[model samples]
Target: MSGDHSTYAPRSGFTKWIDTRLPLPRLMHDSFVSYPVPRNLNYAYTFGGILSIMLGLQMLTGIVLAMHYVASTDQAFTSVEFIMRDVNYGWLLRYLHANGASFFFLAVYLHIARGLYYGSYKAPRELLWILGVVILFLMMGTAFMGYVLPWGQMSFWGATVITGFFSAFPAVGDWIQRLLIGGFAVGQPTLNRFYSLHYLLPFMIAGVVILHIWALHVTGQTNPTGVDIRKKTDTIPFTPYATIKDALGMSVFFLVFAYFVFYMPNYLGHADNYIEANSLKTPAEIVPEWYFLPFYAMLRAITFNLGPINSKLGGVLTMFASILVLFVVPWLDTSKVRSAVYRPVYKVCFWLFIVDCLLLGWCGSQPPQGAIVLTAQLGTLYYFGFFLIIMPLLGLVEKPRRLPNSITEAVLSRRQTSAGRPAGATAAPEDRG
Candidate 1:
């Protein structure tokens, strides 16, 4: 039974109290009622929700771990050990934080890929995708710095190698390097700064993600079918529909996460990090985490160091640019069609881009040997070309096949006709190869 609006007036007591303090109704309306989200937003859209939940997990587990962590280089390694040995349920926090980073990235990359596939970055949704890019950069920076806080060998050298990328800029290269390291090298001062920054960046990511959500909310979500939402008939309330999809998606994602936690938690970790940090000694193969490897490979691809230009700053700039180039993807992609399925030329380039990234990642882990250097050069060229050259070209030259008139038609046509199931109705994903 519903209350009679004619007999009701504005609340004066507990309703007012809750409205002023929590504003639950307003939040519910904004999130579920007023928002007109697409009906066909498949599994990909759930990644953004999963990412939001994982960020909360990271913050909680990180805070608890930080309580046991010593920022000092002298005790940082021992503190990790002490947590393992002394603190109650410390391993849970540590495992959660470490694997949580991987899961966060997993969700983000999927979210971005979803955007890429759906043309979610075009026009009104451009700012949302851009915000996601910025959030990505923040996540990378946060992860890089956080890896160093453990005061392990891989942590130290990985920090050195990655921070060294900043020197790619002219003039202030050395100064930036010293500032980052807090001296000429990674030591106690570097550990302290990294610790402080690592703690601070998650909050920064949260702030950016708020902007990301706002941007996404303004334009709503993109679906796999690249259909547009124009009227109430074309859309559904964001709640029960999108919420259920998000819930299911998170459940699947957590299954993958649980597998990592239970079976291969340390599979993502480096062995050298088991050792304590030492300024005097360095690991023979001090590679950054797998996520940073592609960019790292890009930096090493450039062999000639030009004085201070060739210093740590140059390395830093090259590395940062590797991902920074991503922010401009919407501009680079010239095709009018948003879906990769529609663009034959674009789809092939997409796979090449994936290959280039994997090759670059592989080469980054190798020493700067003769063959590896050559391979890195090829991969680097392809990497830049994928975005800078191919994407722009595909936009101009490629002809997009006819697209569906609307999202509803696209979703309906897939089901069937009264005549019977047409060819490819309820079809499996074609092997685009």
Candidate 2:
């Protein structure tokens, strides 16, 4: 959506008047239809569009769920049950909203991974990347608060446990905890506060999403080659080419999302949540949703103090830092080469980092004792190390493969190789550089 040149032409008198006064239709045509994108972009780019759709779906379903939801602790659980049992297609709506959050996070994670692989955070797109990370933080907060709306066993204690992390601060910790739960404990106030915020934060996320899109359009999109768009030949209009690919990708993604919604609605949720909240009886073990597992593992990983800081504070800092670090990734990485495909060592470490995150997620789900604790600790180390150490050091030392002269060259070379032809078999065009 970066190209500002508009080719929109209103055909009718009323349309021409509207175009002159408002230009709304012209804006759409220019932004979505006529905008230019890299020809080399792949399916990974579709996650952005998918995320937009999921956000709207969540807002729509959440509004309906909220209309019938009771914020009171006594009725919150029952209200959810009522929706599922008596309301018109409430079960479908509930399942869709629940499953939609999981799918939303899934798409975002893949989107972030693609960015890391192709170095979308580098250079002119740094603000675009930062805005994305901000959206992610908003999503996490929104999801966590929304998770607590049901007032189920997990919802109640999950709120209690997660909010309690704020109390790890040395001086203001207790105050922050009180502020979050609206009191010393997770009770009526906590539910009301979380409910109100859960309702409002999605719209806030939407605002940031608008800014995110603006930033994306401003910087344009990055491709797999990490090369800047240099000529018209290296790009295509957004209407038919990128739109078709995005549609196919979204179709496949929605198919999987539908399967989860229809058949295994509760597959991703915990059984303990089906039971109503009982403060008197705590579950044997507390585990958050899958998306939070890796960070949860990191939070529990710190079992020892670092001099003045105790283990509890240390863990809290580490967990928050894990997310905050992402904001500064633009500077943390020292690589001149944008894409991991060009850097052998970075490519290997990138995959290993993914494995480490999965391992941490597994560790987070298990009881943190014996080997799980140790594994979580190691995973935590690597999680930070990948960003703090490897990213900075490897970029300086690693030798990357030679990049093609331009995006067009890379695309043509790949096509030729795949067709049993040698690289550079295609006719060479004038290099923009």
Candidate with top lDDT is 2
Model 2 bad stretches (over 4 Å):
1-4, 421-433
255-361: candidate 2 lDDT, tens digit per residue: 99999999999999988999999999999999999999999999999999999999999999999999999999999999999999899999999999999999999
Query: How many steric overlaps are in each model, in order?
Result: 13, 0
Candidate 2 lDDT trough over 10 residues, lowest sum: 424-433
lDDT for position 71 in model 2: 96
lDDT of 1 at 426: 53
Error of 2 at 392 (Å): 0.8
Give Cα-based local distance difference scores for all models: 0.80, 0.93
lDDT (C-alpha) at residue 86 in model 1 = 86
lDDT of 1 by residue, 1-433 (tens): 1111112223678766776777665555666555677776778778888999999999999999989999988899999989877899887778888989988887887777677767778777778888888899889889988899888999888888666655555678778888999988788888898889999999999999888887777676777666667555667766678788889999988998999987897898898899987768878887888877888888888776666565344555666677888888878787778888788888788778777888998998898799998898899888888889988987899988788788788767765563354444555658222
For every model shown, what is its TM-score relative to the native structure? 0.89, 0.96
